[model samples]
Every structure is written in C-alpha cells, then in structure tokens.
Target: MTFPAFVDLLRQLYVNVAEHEFALPDKQQTDSRVSLLTGVHRKEVSRLRGAGAPVRVVPDSVSRTSAIVARWLADPQFVDARGTPLPLARTSEAGEPSFAGLVESVTRDLRPRAVLDDWLDRKLVEIDDEDRIVLMEGAMVPRGDGEVRLYYFARNLGDHAAASVENVLADAPPFLERAVHYDGLSEELARSLEAYSREIAVETLLRLNKYANQAIQNDPGGSSRWNWGVYILTSDATSLVAEETPENKNAGGETA
Candidate 1:
C-alpha cells in the first residue's frame, strides 16, 4: 500500500494489458511494447513481462457459505411471507426449511451439522429457545475475517474506480455512477437524511440479493461476474472534500 508498491502493481497491470490485449506475434518484442505504452523502463518491463496478472486470494468456503446465506434470505422455503429468514429446525425430518435441508440444497459434500457448528463458532447463527437455527443480521457478508474483508474492499472499490476511469477516458459504454450531494445542512437534518439513506439502501440491497439468489438457481455457471453495491456518507466537514460545483460530479458512488 506504499507508493512504491502501488507503482509496482500498476506497472504489472500495464504489462498484462500490453501482453494480453496488445500482444505482438513476435513474443520477444512484448517487453518493448509494454515499455512504450506504459513508459516503464524496458529492463523492468522485461523482468515483469509474462508474469500472470495478480489475483486476490479468496477463502475456500466463502462462496458456498455466501450461497447458502443468500438462499436462506431469498428462497421461500427458508423465509416467511415477509421475506425474512425463519428459524430452521435442525433436520429435514423435523420440518421444511430445516438447516439440514438448506445445506443439502446448496451442497451435500459438507455435512449440515458441521456447517452449523462452524456458523455457531463464527457467530453467524445461533440456536434460539426453540433450538432452531437463526441467522444473525448481516451474516451473509464476511466482515469479521480481515482477509475476506480486504478481498471485498479491493473488489468493490476497484470496480467502482475502473468504471469511473472508463467514463473519463471515454472508453466505449459508460457505467452507471450517480449521487446527490448537498451542503448547508444543520447537524440534525444531516443525521435525519443519513438515517433515511441507510434504511433505503439496506432495503434495496436485500431485495436485489434475494432476486439474484432465486434467479441464479437454474443457472449453469458462467464466466461473467456481476455485483451491485451502495454506500451512504454524511460528513461534518465545513467544506466539500473536492472543489465545489453545482452538481455532484466526483466519481465516488453514494445512495443519497
């Protein structure tokens, strides 16, 4: 995260783009091409050339856990009429939407009992008075694990930044990035607006997550990845973070 590290990462990306997107049939000349395009030293480009693009490390179980959690939030079998997840009995024989049934619906390789134990340890779920498994709010997202949090931080921020860059550079299709920024607010008004913004934001995200969860059940896995994210900000600073303008034009995305 130091300047030098960032530079190195950018340099690597440039080389990857040049090699993969702008490759010459003459393989030995790739370093020179990358150097010309990125203004990196040819020697440095040569050293970095053909190094595979850096990939973020993801924990092995995140995808499966996320899928199960999403389904629990979405699938009617697991949620009540109001779309809230229901407390599940321990096994399928006990009733529908039991923890055992939910796990097997996602995957049979991992035992339901084992997953339940892990979730309990992680504080993602708890057994209530009736001894039914109940999901904690915001349990679908991995926040406590620092590594998982960092991976998501990079993915969300990186994609938003990329979209903004593409727009500034006028690269083909533009991405959707919009916000409403206002000033001259009293603390009370700002806090009220912030509260309203968060309520609407959480609702929007949960609705979309549910829709996506149901929609993807029949899907054969595809290469394209998709995400929708939102943020809300209310700052007490006397001045705008960037130079003031009539309209909100800075690229940072927000819901309010």
Candidate 2:
C-alpha cells in the first residue's frame, strides 16, 4: 500500500485509542486493525512493527487522550506506520530565535580563530573569485591573547563589476575590520571597487533588516540601529590621532 494509506491507518488507531480510553491492541489485534483500516494485509503491519514502528498505549482511562498526545509529542522519532515524523508545535525562547540555540551549540564546539578565518575566506571568495581579483593584504589582528581583529583587501583589473562584491564585504560578520581603499585610477579598477562598494551597501542593509526584526520582537519602540554598539580603545600616552574616513564612517561618522 501507499505510504499515505499506512499513515492514515496509524492516525485512525491513535484516534480510536483516544476515544475508547483503552490500551492499544496487542500484536494480533494491531494486525487486524491495520488490515481493517488500510485494507493492507495483517502481515504488513507485523513487518512494519518489527522495523521500529512506534506503538504507544494509554495507561489511564481518565486522561487517555492527553497521555497519548503527550507521548506522541515528546518522541522525536515518532512516525506514522507510513514513516513520517509527526509535526509538533514549536516554542521559541524569550530572547532567542528558533535556530539560535543550534547555531550557538555548533559554534561553541569550534575553535574561535578557525571559525572566524573560515567565514572570512568564504566572504572573500564571494567578493573576488569571479572578478579575478587577488587578495593582497590580510591579517587577523590579535586583540590581547584570545580575541582577533581581522583585516583584508583585494585588488583587480579596473573594469570588474562592483555590486555583489561590495555586498559580501560590507555584510561580513561583525568581527572583521572591513574597508575598500582605492589603489589606482584606472577605469577598469575603479568600476570594480564601485561594484564592491555597492554590494557591501546592500549587505549592510540586509543586516539592518535582521536587526530591525529582532528589535521589533524584543521592544515595541526600540531603534533598529541600536541592535549593535561600538567600543573605542586608545593608549594612554600615545601621540596618535585617529581620523574617521568618509567611507568607513558608521552611523555617526565617527571613529570607534
């Protein structure tokens, strides 16, 4: 029989147990119920049960339906006789999205530097691979002993397209220090950088969208731009002056 038919039979059995307030049928009775509900041979039910088909029983008549529903809900591998996982309602945490916990779990098991480097490499490829640009200067600045400051730059022939490339750089993860500095005035090179810049702008806008969505869910009037904050550090006695570049300016056009 078709998979859907098998599933229907299993569901009917569940409903029957729910309404009748009785234990699920024994093996022989189960086979008979399958044959009656799905028009499949009793032998088919026996075979499926041997192959790990889950059969649950209600222990108490007073709350039989609730008990059966709860059992089905708790079992991650609970499938119908046809072998489809039953859909269950999902509950999200107060401050976390559905996949946030999974992401954190995976990241926690990885080396921080390795993860950062790998993600940066992917972003670089998206920005430069097709345009034949070569990444020239790249470094992961050590922030004390455990943190890093990632920086990279690439160069290409003056005429490459700029849109998608720019987006990759701008939308890169927040840990990276990103900028596009012009090296020469050739028309082809300038066009490529322009494309890179535009793409980065697009990526930034997408990041803003994510931040805005989070803000709305967290606080009704929270500012989307407030989703991220900046920190500035300086040496106590150095004579160095940090000037903000027009292109690298954040929301306030100031150095951080």
Candidate 3:
C-alpha cells in the first residue's frame, strides 16, 4: 500500500508486458515501448527484461462453461416459478426451451452439446431422472481448475477496476456505476441481501454476456474488449455500510 511498494509492482507489471504482450504478435517489444506503455524508466525496463524475472502469469480468456452457467442462473427464460433455475431438458420439446437452447442463446458458435458435456464433466450442472439438466452453485467459480480461476481472477478484476475509473472520469452518462446503501440491518437481513444480490447479479451478467457474445460473433476480428461486472458488499458487525442493488430483483429475473 505504500508508494515504494506500488512502484515496485508497477516495475514488475512493465516487465510482464515487455516479456509477454508483444512476444508473439508484435515481436517488437523494445525497452522503450515497455517504458512508454508502463511509465517505467527505460533502463529499469531493460534491466527487468534482461534479468529473467518471474512475471505473473495472467489468464487470457474466461471459461466458456462458466459463462454458460452464469447465463442459466441469470436468464429468466431458464428459471422456474420459484425463481431458481429450472432443470432444462437436453433438447427442446414442441418449441419449449431446453438446455441446448439456453447455451445457444448466449453463444451460437459453440456447439450446445459440447458446452453441455463440458458443464457435466466439470460438475457445474447435473442431469436428473428425466434427463433434465440442472444447474448447480459456483458456476462462476472454477472448481479444481486453478489455471482457469487465475485467468478470470485477474482479467475480471482488472476490467472491473478499469470500468470504475472510466466512469469516474467520464463527462456524461457514466459507464453503469450504481448502487444502494442501507445503514441499519439485522444479520438475517444482511444474509438475505447477500444471497439476493448474487441472484440478481448473475442474471444481469448473463444478459450482458449474451449480447457481448453476439457482438463478438458479428465482428470476429474486433480489436477492443468489452466487459461488465457485478459485485456486492455487506456490513461485518452490524455497523453502518452501503449496499447498492444495480437492478430490481424481479421474480423471473432482473431489470437493470
């Protein structure tokens, strides 16, 4: 948290960019470029790059299976009367929606059955007696897959921070930074809010995932990356704290 420590972290980040970011596609990762991009001194960039320092390995892509499960939790068409995700049939029946349909809605390019198999193998979902596919908890959290979790842990946190900064700096229509705060609440209510937040956040992210995937599909070679985030916080010991509900938690889904 100190300035000196922060500077060291920045230097390490510069080394990371120098060593990896341009090594493949650009292959023009000069010390000056790293210095300019990272705001580290040219000499330090060279030193860090030449020292063979162990740079942090950042994960590049999020798990597609996890994204699918998140969508299932968030999408209303995929849920039942109780507001829990319905155990969907593998294949559609008479125009009714199925698990395959749910996956396809988010990612048309990925084969639905392949996605299903991956989810089942990962234990993110389970098949029931009627062959219905039921979604399970921790869809967004990687289980036993340390590498995948690492990738998302870095990528999502980075983007989420970037979005918040952008919103603060923007002149008009801030980039979707909103919340609600309450000062006094019992532990039971706080716990209820936590679970409630997860349900709503999942649904909102799923909606965003669906549209973003579609945009990516439409423009396969787009250079820029797009992302959105949802998170919740609560008081630790009946103290004053703020809570923000990005959207109203509806019975079927969210309305942001």
Candidate 4:
C-alpha cells in the first residue's frame, strides 16, 4: 500500500487504542497487530514490515518490527508540499527540542500556528497538522551529539484554542537531550513523532468527547439556554448609560 494509506491505517489503529485502551496482541499471536486491527492478512503485514512499511506492534515488540508505526502523532517531514523544510525548534545545544517536546511546548503555550511559523523560520524542523488532528514528527541533533528524534500527536484545538495551548508550552520546561533528539530530524523522526502524538491525542480526545456527549445527553430538554450573542454598541456605549436615576439625583438636582 502507499505510504499515506499506510499512515491512515495506523491512525485508525491509534484511535482504537485511545478509545478502548486496546492492548496490542503479543508476538506469539497468530495474527499480527496490524491484521487484527485492520483486517489485513498477517502475511501482508509481515511483508509490509519487511519492506520498511510502518506496522503496529506491542510496545514490547517495537524493536522486533523493522518498520513499526511511530508511538506519537507528529508528521516528521520538515518539507512542505513544495518540499520546503521548516526551521528547527532547538534553542540551545543543551536544550535541543524534539518534535515531541515542540508539540508539548505548543500544547502548553497554545500557539501552535505561531510555533509552526517559528519552526519554519528556524529551518531545522518541520510540522504538519492539516489533518483532523495535528501531527508533529521531527528530529534534533546537538552540534557534537548524535541525533535525537521525536514523534507527537495533538488534537486540533481549533485555531484559537491551539494558540492558547501554544502559549502554555512556551513557558514549560525545555526538552531534555537524553530523551529523543540524537540526530537532526529525519524520516525515522517523523515515524516516531506520529506514533507518540497519535496515542496521546486519541486518549485525551476520547475522554473530552465522552464528557461533551454526556453533557448533551443530560441536557436533552430545551430548558437550558446560554447567552452568547454579540451586540454592536454606539461609539459612546459606556457613556450612554446614566449612573444615577432621577429619584437618586444629587443635592443640586443633577443626574450622577
């Protein structure tokens, strides 16, 4: 199957895991995790894995699979559709940020778009979230160190909410070098970020969606209403209102 198609299948598996907390099947199982999740044949899954196609596997079996799906949700390709690579996200050698950390920073700060632009400017990292969910996959490499890689998945918190989360991340602790970034971001980096991000977003969104659905269900009747309308006022909107009534006039009989 095509790479994009494979990525989509992996995404569905991630959603299933997030919604149900589905444990991956053990290696001893007759069917591979991919087949069980996608109804694809185990042999096909094996072939794909051998061919460097990303396959889903148990955490314990990650090393065994040649082409395992990333644990996070970020797409690690630094290049855009036009093949333009984005700027990197690291600020200092000791603070080389992985794609995962960048996502965390964006989520924490709530300014994903700005962060994306910031990443573009650095030309060291690349991010893509055009999908229903945001996926950030990339790598980081300190000048003297090996590459550190990352994968991340984030919910599409609308433009406004994402911006808010980005603001939070900006103030959070920096990503540690020992964690993921060993080399500059690469394709391997993309896979890793995608895997990680998918897992987190799926779990978080499921809970949120459940609560929202429950709220709607509990308020099925038309008894509740909220006032959220916007009103356009005249230029002197505040000045139009008198502070005091005629009965409460000042000693001079002037309105307060």
lDDT for every model?
0.75, 0.35, 0.66, 0.36
lDDT of 2: 0.35
Model 3, position 229, has a per-residue lDDT of: 70
TM-score of each: 0.74, 0.19, 0.53, 0.19
Off by over 4 Å in 1: 1-57, 171-173, 239-256
Per-residue CA lDDT of candidate 1, range 1-256, in tens? 5798767766765565555545667665566677897788999887776455432334556667887898898888999988889999998764666999999998988999999998998889999999999999848667677656645655566566656666777756477877866665678988998999888987888799888888887899876878788767888765655665656433243431
TM-score of 3: 0.53
Which candidate, 1 or 2, has the higher lDDT? 1
Clashes of each: 0, 12, 5, 60
Query: 188, model 3: CA deviation in Å?
Result: 3.2
Q: Which candidate achieves the best lDDT against the true structure?
A: 1
lDDT of 2 at 138: 21
> Which has the higher TM-score value, candidate number 3 or candidate number 4?
3
Across residues 90-185, which tens digit of lDDT does each residue of candidate 4 receive? 332355434434445324543445544544553434444522223233322112111111111112112223334345566753322112222223
Check candidate 3 and list the clashing pairs. 74-203, 179-244, 180-243, 180-244, 181-243
Residue range 1-256, candidate 2, lDDT tens digits? 4798656545444333322222255533455665555455567645654444222321222122222222332223333444222332122346422222222333455443443344345342122433322212121112322112111000111001122234455655333333334322455655665677666664564355444534444575643322222122222222336654565433222221
Residue 248, model 3: lDDT of: 24
Summing lDDT over every window of 10 consecutive residues in candidate 1, give the lowest-scoring window.
Answer: 247-256
Query: Model 3 Cα RMSD, Å?
Result: 9.0
Highest TM-score: give the candidate number. Answer: 1
